[model samples]
Target: MRIIKWVVRLLVLLAVIFVGGAFLLPKETSVARTVTMNAAPEVIFPYIANLRANQSWSPWLDRDPDIQLAFNDVPEGVGAAMSWQSEHPQVGSGNMIIIEAQDPRRLVTALDFGEMGTATAYFNLVAAEGGTAVTWGFTSDNGNNPMFRWMGLMMDGWVGPDYEQGLNNLKKLVEGA
Candidate 1:
């Protein structure tokens, strides 16, 4: 009886520790990927400007086949907005709006995920080698949410690969176009 009581106590302690750790994790993280396209910045800006254009190469779009997405404002430049709703946890639900644009060069957007949180995404196109080098980046601050502290650790690994894949896909599509 004493052994069982000790075991129960230990289990409770462990649970408390785990919960505490989750609540204490860092809330900010970033992921970035770069790729070069044979096409000019003009050719690539369209893809970055319009969320609708993102369907051609966005890594996440293919993840949830049934996700409902809506776009508004300009179809392919500053002022564009895209929002999505999905039942899948992997897809979650969010909206992103174009907050900055330097035609054929730099594009920046603000993304909000309600309970999931908010983030900033950037796309930069620079001349490199024989083509344009495009870099995609995302960053978010969790505002020290107790439950979201671990997100920063998981985010780099989680988002990095997807960013790389998205860049590669963009390269292929723009090169082919």
Candidate 2:
């Protein structure tokens, strides 16, 4: 009976620690990757501003070959959106809508990952030594959810590689064109 009481106490303590630790974590997290492409921002802006054009270099598409994508009638610039569904768990259902589009400079989108929550993604294009330096970034607010706060700690590790690959793919596509 005494041992069982100690075990219960230990479990309670662990639960408190886990929840408390989450409160101390940052309420938001972000991940970004940049790559220089041998093209001007104007040449790269269209590809990112248009949802349909993104399909050509999206890293997630390669993960789920059969993923279904639906795009809005006006598929470029602000208000354009795309929703995707996939059987692959990693490539789960999500919708992204362009909220801000500044030609040849920046594009911002709001992404809804259904139950997984929502995030903001942006692409910034700036002139570089050779061409345009493109930066792709994602940011999410973990809010007050303990689980999400904890998950925020791993967001960079989880999303960084995808951003890198996507940028590499974009570089190849733009440079090769």
Candidate 3:
């Protein structure tokens, strides 16, 4: 009888710790990865501006070769959007729409993951000595959800490596083009 009572008490304590820890987590999070490519901003910008072009360089595309992709009519600049569905959880269903575009310089997108949430992602370029420095980043708000706040705390570790690989792929494609 005493052992049963202790077990219940321990479970309750763990639950409290988890709930309190989540509340202490940050309300927002962002992850960024940068790469310097041996190409001018003009050369690099076109590849990023078009959603179709991304298929050739995005790491996520390679993850689910059979993923279904639907591109909006605009397809290349502001207003261009793409929706994807994949069986793979890592490449799950979502859509992204280009919200801001500054030719040869920057591009920003509103990314939506249906029930998962929404985020803002951007690609910014700066001219460098022999090429362009490109930064790919995304920011998301956790609101007041303890589960999301916990996710925010681990967002960087979960997404950073993929960002790195995508940038590396972009570098190879542009340089080899």
Best by TM-score: 2
Model 3, range 149-174, lDDT digits (tens) per residue? 88887888989999899999999999
Better model by lDDT: candidate 2 vs candidate 3: 2
Model 1, TM vs. native:
0.84
Q: What is the C-alpha lDDT of each candidate?
A: 0.87, 0.94, 0.92
Stretches of model 3 off by over 4 angstroms after superposition? none
Best by lDDT: 2
Model 3 vs. true fold: TM: 0.94
Cα RMSDs, all models: 2.5, 0.9, 1.3
lDDT digits (tens) for residues 40-138 of candidate 1: 999998888878889999988888999999988578667899999988776789999999999989999999999788899999999999899999998
lDDT-wise, the better of 1 and 3 is 3
| Reference-based lDDT, residue 95, model 1 | 94
TM-score of each: 0.84, 0.98, 0.94
Cand. 1 Cα-lDDT = 0.87
